[model samples]
Target: DESIDIPYFGELNGIQLVNPIWVKAVPYNVKVVGANNNVVTHLRLWSTEPSKKQLVQDEKYLKMVSKISESLYPDDSTDEGKILRLQQQYLFSSAGIQDAIREHKALGRDIKDLPKYYTFQINDTHPTLIIPELMRILMDEEYMGYDEAWSIVTQVAAYTNHTILAEALEKWNIELFKRLLPRIYQIVEEMDRRFRLFLKGKNLSQDKINHMALIGSHDVRMAHICIYGSFSVNGVAALHTNILKEIELNDFYQIYPEKFNNKTNGVTHRRWLMHINPELVNILDKTVKGNWRKDLSAIKELENFKDDESIQKEIKNMKLAKKRQLIDVIYKDTGVKLDENAIFDIQIKRLHEYKRQSLNIFHVIYLYLRLKKDANFRKTFHPQNFIFGAKAAPSYIMAKYIIEIINRAAQIINNDPETKDLLKVVFVQNYNVTYAEYLFPAADLSEQISTASKEASGTGNMKFMVNGAITIGTMDGANVEIVEYAGIENEIIFGLSAEEVTQAYKANSYNPRKIFDNDKRIQDVFKFIKSLDKDEHYFDFVFNNLLNVDYFFVLADFDAYVEAQSRANKLYQDEKTWWRMSIMNIANAGFFSSDRTIKQYNEEIWHLDTIKL
Candidate 1:
């Protein structure tokens, strides 16, 4: 671990800081090792550590200090959890700003020229406190005027909005915020008052002004602070950015049009492609004959050999090898032997209602029922191993229920004599980064099947595409950009468009009960869910949520998703066509590289000069 001295402030002019103790920044460098076991690069990950003296203090203080650097997003169901989460945010943000300023001044750069020498990227609402924190430091410590400090803060900071979900955009209770950090609260209150006056001067209505207020009636809206404070506000994908402008944050976008932009999220091709699937990398190396690793656009040259029988055979073999490796891992981990020959359809992400883990399982139940009842389907159906990997948040009861249901469904489906061979379900426990190394490369079908307009740009979709998995997804988030890059024919696009979903929500026209009653397939799936537990209707909460609320339109998109799955199943039967599409997906995936995403951020927003090591 590399240690850096972090100037911690317990009090600045009689104001208590977030964590009232001096701490050390002991960050370890995460090595990105290549397939050949050589360290390709290093990603320095920063973390907090209390001083040795503080470690020997009273138990209560040590516990409080430790909570600051503990696991992220702790259960905020109680007041204590909320305070800890807020404290964690301030702890990191305050330390980071202090470190940056110290480093800048140590280099003999003037405080007024801080914006020219450095820029801060506020990744999301979690770091929104940085704006006010910076303002406080400049005004109090550097003795700058409020206007000058605000000017410097605006120029140095930028924000990225990663979600459209209201719950995900953080807000702190005003009382709690004020009680914890009095000085920071004071600065934020003044900033809010100033911004409100600025908005009123623009002739905006009071309702609009209130809607865009940083400090609301009872709470401090973090996103509002970010939008008003930062010079640039970007979304993670093309569709996501458009949604923010038109629907989610339209008020802010209308006022600050020039600040809004799009930078579709991406995954590292070197780690996702080269390290994860070295066999595929070797094949591409032989066929493309270019430095595809350095300039991923060179990977598109593989399109020339897409139709070649020899290349197709090689790709098929590589995929099968990966599947076999995954099968062994699943057997070791879960004691469920996956069929290497079966289509490896994977949906792995955070367990959330919008991401629709329930929707995926509903389709699995439908297929299981079809195999039992339909003779033609039993004869003609291609075998499939439906794999799921996810971890629900501790406090999210519904998400946790979905995980239980997926596992319960897996248990029933895998043990069934009638469908065990043809259809197998495997929910890998404790899904994390290590398991993802196996899951991404082995996938035959990547399920980006969230309800329309829900997901921010999903890097998982890009990871699956780069590793040659055909996507069966809704036209949402980065899936839209994936289709544009990989071609529509190469992917299985389904469900409501983002605009249609938005219109449905706006019109309040969606009725899940009607769709459930109309569709016999959906009814059969629910029947299976009901039968999973005889003593009680354990999953009735899920059923009720779907019928009563259906916030994500799972029932509305059910028929379309099933049809798309059928199409993918049939397409998988044709070896030549499947391999060709897989090749095409890999070739076109160069556009979704992290290298491309970073380049765009530097060119458009940051404009930081490149320096040689």
Candidate 2:
């Protein structure tokens, strides 16, 4: 994507750059942003034949993505990768600045208009050095004075923060910084020095200095730089917004409180709701009496008929039909014959420990053991089709093992005649955005049981809720705001609060061993893994990670999850009650739409006016 260049460059949208390689926008629409803005020109560059370039460079990677049409790219994975990414940033930044100068020279436009026409939004910190890069164009390439270029860079550009996870946040080593981006490093050092002097007169402390240095270090204190340097900054959820201030950015919040804002994330309801489930959409349009398609707040009209039995029956039938369609998909992909009558319990997301597949698996094993021991446990319960869709990061060993265990458990439970009808487990492979559309609408239950404070904000939870699935979640991510929107009774919430998790960590109060030893169900689940004494490698894989590493407190939450799952099953048996709850969830889900989030951003941060044309 990058090389040392004589000219300026900008960016290639990730999708466009990796085109037709994975899932593609089938019928492409050519969108021209402006025919006559009298402003600036930006070129989006791609290899036109990108897959050929990819295959020529890495035949191994090209082969990996063939089955699912997905690629595992790590050309920029190391310190070298970081350097390559930074080089791409500067390439685009300097190119854009110089491109602006060239256009001005040809067109004979006033040079001062650069500020008005040259505003650049660095989508994420992957391009954070762009400010310094732009500075180089002005001072070194453009040969403008230091202060003059710095002024132009500041006025011309801003950034966005994508994630709060520690690993996802990037920071370059000082050595990497010096080797790959020497000139930009000099500009950053100078900026750090000047900022230090500014802080010195204001009576700054050492702690603040260390914090800011790490924040703006070549790795980039991205959210802060985006927030403080840009005209505005915002988070993807209401709770996340408050969280940014209360936790992640507490120091900076005090330093500059008003800068951080909330622009809750939203999905394009067009893709999520309309295109995916046109049948349910038809029923909604007929019953609710308007197209909620354009403005989701119109779903509020559904509140009037929450108690209407006829409408409730229609919604229930519509959901069941969608479930039947999903079963067709399941049959083709995994050769698993699923009963649509069984409760479609689902958990689909990236396979990360913090998302707590361990807790969910413990609950599944606990149920399996209970059924094995108590013969009559089946009579009282509705049969459940526990469906999991996840893809582990190829290098994440524990996550890959988790998938294998889930597959093995599915084989064990599904093949046994006694449990075949009552309980079925299926692990669908290669979970991605395209498959998520099918999973969201077909789900009877959305499992969002991440340990509190771990998931930054789950966009998936909102998607399922909007599709009328009941969420059984924790008080983390967007779930807090979701339960608030849908109201408590409309959804089910379990487990600790973010504050409680933080306090527990501070006190060192959690004990996975004690929890595992006392609860026989949890104990049996662990014992079941170890009792696979027959399968030493698999048990060793599970045990060494759980009992030895034991960091995520999987054992601690196992019982609570079993209790929650049991409660959910009991609710599932009450057909009328479940239908009403599902209705109310969709009715209240308007708040979670990206339309609302974008509107909030346009109002509070970007101040972008709609350019519908």
Candidate 3:
């Protein structure tokens, strides 16, 4: 198995050294057992088993293993680690470009014709080094001139930005960039120079030109490189695209207004709807006309079924079935049993402060406090199960702290005799793609509570919509579009709009501390967080974060969020209306199909004709 014959390409002198290459599949979850782990020992044994002529090829691999063991780390948070990541990017991109050229050569096509055959859309700035790498291949390897290489490279590449978070924007220090990639850096430097001259020719201000430059004061902005090298630059959603034009990438937008565009993010309904909710798919297949699978717009026909009692009841039954499946999983994983009758209010995404998992937890705490304070409200209140699933990035201290508090709150509330059955709390561990298939459909309410203007676009919101879960969300990201599709009365929309949030920041008029002091309900929530018995140390930071730095405006939107929840609860009491709203969500979600998105991309951006199977 290790001596499997494969196509070989030698880097040195372009001659094959080995007739066959030894390839091995390594498990990611291999046990660490001192010096001889399973992977290491297995590889070591395979290499030492001798060759046909009894030549020892083992030493070469042993040396490689030793070097890898010494250089590689468990924690990729250091300068060396950062450099390693850059090295990986360069290696992957360079190799991929080389392969593409090899394929072009096999077809007997001129290298300049590469643009007609291939267009690489760089999703985010991760693979942006490929632009310069391709240029280097053309100019250096193929002996093409700089102008010719630049033209071909520009035609073959496009970029899509997914986030406006400053930290998420990729930038490499000039020293590290030049040291690691001397040739690519040279090409980038020339590109930056040409861009600056082009801006000067347009009579643009030097300040604005500097802001839009590929290379900044001490670093090379990867996004700027992407924008400069690519034929087009796009954002993931409409609002996100507008914000990119007006705010984040404003300088670039001004210079190349024609290059900027919007492609609102979409999810594959085949995965989110057809596969995940097969029962609902079966019902739709029976009731809805035409092939809705191929033509998602046909899902709009389900709007007529909204008023039908039988269909509404069937939808409710489907949700209950999903809840039963999820409850079994929760119990198996976390040993926490959830009530089937309780409202399954779910918030699941990556743990980030802006996404506002903390706000959800705070509202849960407020409800707990209310139950403890008022007997009549406790008796009358709807039984609710607040479910959460998230994973914090290892380096993000605040996100990890947020997870800890959520778990801490869950532990306290779920154990309390008074609140255990009345209000359950569960935070599912290691939430992933496999889990989402089960999670989205079972939800009574979907939480899309990211701060207004902060979220790029949430496909999870769309997935939930297709699965018939009503969103209680801010008018941000695709949620604005979702509200429009579902009707404003259906999806709970409560928050400052993007313009209002931006204006508040411009005026420097917003203060979280004032809200904390002024609002009793918010004050009580903060007080409870401070007074929590478990994780007392973390509570101080959480308290400080709110009073001193509520960057996501959790306290600012707290009242509106709570009022929305109250409204949701009241509406849930009217089962007929709630199911009708859920049906509306399912009907409107047809527009969110990735088939439509890809069709748009093919027509507008990629300009490629579809090939029928």
Model 1: per-residue lDDT, tens digit, 1-613? Answer: 3354333334445543544445565556687764344437765556666666343567766677677677887888899999888877887787678877877988999999998887799998998889999998998889999999999999999999999999989999998988777788889989999999999999999998888999999999999999999999999999999999999999888899999999999888878988889999999999997789888989999999889999999998999999998999999999999888999999999989999989999999999988988989989899999999998878999998888878888898899999899999989977899899999999999999988899988999999998899999999999999999889999999999998999998899989999999999999898888888884578888899999989999999999999999999999999999999999999999999888999999999999886433
- Model 3 lDDT tens row, 163-213: 988877888889887766665777899889998999899998899888888
Worst 10 residues of 2 by lDDT: 18-27
Give me the candidate number with maximum lDDT.
1
Error of 1 at 289 (Å): 2.5
Number of colliding residue pairs in model 3: 0
Residue 330 deviation, candidate 1, in Å? 0.6
Per-model TM-score on C-alpha atoms? 0.94, 0.84, 0.88
Model 1: residues with Cα > 4 Å off, grouped in runs: 1-57
Worst 10-residue lDDT window for candidate 3 reads 41-50
Candidate 2 global Cα RMSD: 6.9
Off by over 4 Å in 2: 1-45, 48-124, 155-158, 214-228, 531-545, 548-551
RMSD of each: 2.9, 6.9, 7.8
Ranking by lDDT: 1, 3, 2
lDDT of each: 0.88, 0.69, 0.81
